[model samples]
Target: MEIRVLGIGCARCNELEKRVKDALAELGIAANVEHVTDLKEIAALGVLMTPGLVIDGKVASQGKVPSKDELKKLLGGGK
Candidate 1:
């Protein structure tokens, strides 16, 4: 799967990346995780806020870092 974490190298952005990795590890899923730091790219993805989470090219969450449990859901484990 393809996952993108959009941010401008902020703490929250880094934390979100870590959470994404942790969630992926817990779920035993291998994904190509990328960190998007370009403003243009992030905007093109339609994320208006930092710490955006994009799963398989679709916007999943934005503006704040989500908990690992929440990430598990976002990663397709739950509703």
Candidate 2:
């Protein structure tokens, strides 16, 4: 799976990326995590907020960092 974290290298953005990685690791999923800081690319996603999480080309979360559990759910985990 491909996961993209969109931000301008802010603290929140970095934290979100780390949380995402931890969540994926817990779920045992191998994903490619990328940080998108380019304005043009970020705008193309139509996100007006920083610290956005995009999973497989679809925007999953934005504005703030979500908890690991929330991320796992977003990744389609749990019973």
Off by over 4 Å in 1: 77-79
C-alpha lDDT of candidate 1 relative to the true structure? 0.91
What would the per-residue lDDT of candidate 1 be over residues 1-79, giving only the tens digit for each residue?
Answer: 8999999999999999999999999899989899999999999988999999999878999999999999999996422
TM-score of each: 0.94, 0.94
In model 1, which range of ten residues has the least summed lDDT?
Answer: 70-79
Can you list the residue pairs that collide in candidate 2?
Answer: none
The lDDT of model 2 is 0.91
Tens-place lDDT per residue, model 2, 1-79, is: 8899999999999999999999989998888899999999999998899999999888888898999999999986422
For model 2, the stretches where C-alpha displacement exceeds 4 angstroms are: 77-79
